[model samples]
Target: MDPAPARLAVAVKAQARALGFDACGITDASPPGSAPHFANWLAAGHHGEMAYLARNAARRVDPRKVLPGLRSVVCLAVSYPGDHDNPPPPPALRGVVARYARFTDYHDVLAARLRDLTAFLNGLGGAEARSLWYVDTGPVLERDLAQRAGLGFIGKHTNLLGRTLGNWCLLAEILTTVALAPDAPERNRCGTCARCLDACPTRAFVAPFVLDARRCISYLTIEHKGPIPLELRPALGTRIFGCDDCLAACPWNRFARAGRLMREHTRADLAAPDLIELLRLDAAAFKVRFAGTPMARAKRRGLLRNVGVALGNLGDPAALPALRQVAQDPDPLIGEHVRWAIERIEAP
Candidate 1:
């Protein structure tokens, strides 16, 4: 409540920008405004296999549950727009990774920066300050907090889009007892634009501002552990990792500049990977290839499972040899998908 904490907020934002964060703002660590919507989403089973969302539902509403007596939340964004040189891969035997995952894991990148911000705040607030930070790994309603902090409004497609950064930014949060002054919330800017919703390959957006992860290509390719549903396989197309159709379709992205820090981390090879090569990756090879990247999170089997669907959708006979090899593999998850790919290629 003190004016000193208000001044500290200004300094924190300046320092965060210096550390390469694209945007920064503060909000009181009260319950998230989206708690009701989140509860509804979970009750409707829209979250699918992401059981952790249900498990951590309570903690998301109240930051104090994760960090006792938390009074301020410092939210930050770092843009990861795809490299200007790296356009979407041609729809062929090539598989596309989400632009964000085309680089080093954002979790690691954003967490390190948030830690530095925490140390700065702790030093300013003295021993009375307690701080904890998260980079998408926490049970926080990040979009709600980010919107409340004035960074951006949550777009109808369910992503936070800033006037400048569009939907191409990653978010991080720091919860602290330092009591920084909060920023005013941003007004909703998505008046009539529904391009993001209309662009979904799998019709994941059940309605404006609501997403069904059950049918989302990103969720299917990355989060869902078992085989992808047959109904969604054709929509999976050549996207092996995550999908960016909705985010890329946002008209606001016309204002988005290429990511400065993330540009250096983008791997050209990952921009449009050869599906045949990905199918050959055994567990050991997968780890070695995508060691520090977000792609590693899917593991070899999950990624290969996705690759089979993509190859099937491509219906490219060039992939038949690889799919046949994978069909004989010991992992039923991948083998089953490989068999499906073979059927699709062989089908009239």
Candidate 2:
């Protein structure tokens, strides 16, 4: 066992922490152990409209497919203050953005830091070293790789959870050509626990570890751009962006730590946005408000569509006029959801 590679792994982790990552680990870039399960999950049509996941299926199972000569994966986690990240939705008709989305787009926030870390890794491994970093969009089974790297274990909710960061952390990875010592993997500790499965309002979990994204509030609101199915609209409550009930229910959060990197990027305004205000956001206004946030990726129509469902679930009569006004929105998606809101408020 050469000491040089082990020393390099330690330095890389220390550098990651200095860059504001809360947890970091190193793992060999072998094909993820869950590749077959993932293929079966995709085949089961549980991914909903996220076709990109299916298209990148092959690359996702193997880091070598993504980067030739990839020898190591640097797994990093950044915890956003889980304790207060999700304040109860305000008394007013305000909508809740998921804890992760309340910050400036995490991808943008983490990318800058990842670039610096990659550069540092390159320098540590000498001139011929090369690396590529991605927050969550990279074609790799990051959650499984994170566990193999000893950063965390995959819980029943299918989220990576660590004693220190819980399931409330965001993951990033850097695939590098440099060889490094692999850390011991963490084994699952969710024995006799099903809180996350029970916490889901829409029963998104088909079984202990299988999630059906079609019924997931986060996916229905954030990823699926078309009108949400009628059956799931009421379950959305006021969550206009993403859902965190499953993550919040995890017991491991007893050790949840506050993260430094995301604190700097938090958008206080997104904590509890006025539902009506959000519903009325035209394209220009939407862009101005959510320019650098995760909601920007959802776009104006998608967000307001969510806003309409939220207002409907809130069942407040006061929101009717606004819902009615937006029922004729130029974007049919917004109009459809807004019309649903109007009917819901009008229902006996």
Candidate 3:
């Protein structure tokens, strides 16, 4: 690599920081060799109903297929740290949403910043600027690319753990035709740390550096579209959107700080939503409430379904009315979950 290219890479990093990314790094766009592991994971039915993972297996392993002539992957991390854990539910509330869903959807926020970065890179040296940006909407092995870019290591929980920002940050990638100098992969910093592994209520981690998505609370609530596995519901606790137990348990988060650009994105109403209110939400109401938030991805039916599970976990008789009301929901999945909740709440 020419020194000029290296210098340009350094300048790009600075520009990325100025553009509001918490951290940035460049890596050569290459197929990550995690396909065997992914294949095994899928074969074991660990991905549950997230069939998309299996559908794009080849494209996900290689960024080049998604964007031909991809020479570099500019990975960015944006912190969305909260001042506190999920908020306490109201006296009669039964569900609690995870903190990440509390604010504006990170996909929009981070994609905008990535567009700016790509524009900046294009202006430099008059490159054609052919590039694609992804905020979890593309077939890309983002965490692996982040690690290759020296941005972070894939922690035991399988999240990209930035040395400075921990796992509370969102990842976005810009695959470009520009051939910026690449950074060496970072060393794993999770030495002797098993807190994340031990904190998993579902024992999702089959072993170090591996996660069985089927048993992960985040996957169960947010990714799985059908009825949640009976055995995993009890381990979900009150997490209705996603789970952060493993991320929170990581020791490196002690040094993590909320990114200045995303300070306003901290936990808001969704820190812990009232389960009763969530269950009562119709499609229109759910859309209005979660218009700009990540929770909207779950859609009205999906979210209400999770709320039913949370209500079941609460096992409070006071939640009977809310559960029964949703039991007649138009969506079969929501109604099924509501019935499940009714059984759990009425038991004993």
Q: Which stretches of candidate 1 lie over 4 Å from their true place?
A: 83-85
> Distance (Å) between predicted and true CA of 143, model 1?
0.4
**What digit string (tens of lDDT, one per residue) describes model 3 on residues 186-276?**
8788889899999999999999878888888888888878888888888887778988788888888887877876666654677767888
Cα displacement (Å) at residue 239, model 3: 1.3
When sorted by lDDT, best at the front, the candidate numbers are 2, 1, 3
Q: Each candidate: RMSD to true structure? A: 1.2, 1.0, 1.9
Choose the strongest candidate by TM-score: 2
**Residue 125 in candidate 3 has what lDDT?**
44
Candidate 2, residues 1-348, lDDT tens digits: the string is 999889999999999989999999999978988988899899999999999999999999999999999999999999897746557766889988888888888999888999999999999999999899989879999999999999999999999999888888999999999988899999999999999999999999989889999999989888897889998888888899998899999989998888888888878898889998888787888899998888898889889989988888888999988888888988998898888888888999
TM per candidate: 0.97, 0.98, 0.94
lDDT of all predictions, in order shown?
0.88, 0.90, 0.83
Q: Pairs clashing in candidate 2?
A: none
* Candidate 3 similarity to native, TM-score: 0.94
Flag clash pairs in model 3.
none
State the lDDT of candidate 1 residue by residue for 1-348, as single tens digits.
468978999999999999889899899988887899999999999999999999989998888899998989999998876446578787779898888998888887777778888999999989888998889888899999999999999999999989888888999999898888999989889999899999998999989989999999999989999879888899988889988889888888888876577776777788899889999998889999999899998999899998888888888898898788889889999999999999999999
Q: Could you tell me which residue pairs clash in candidate 1?
A: none
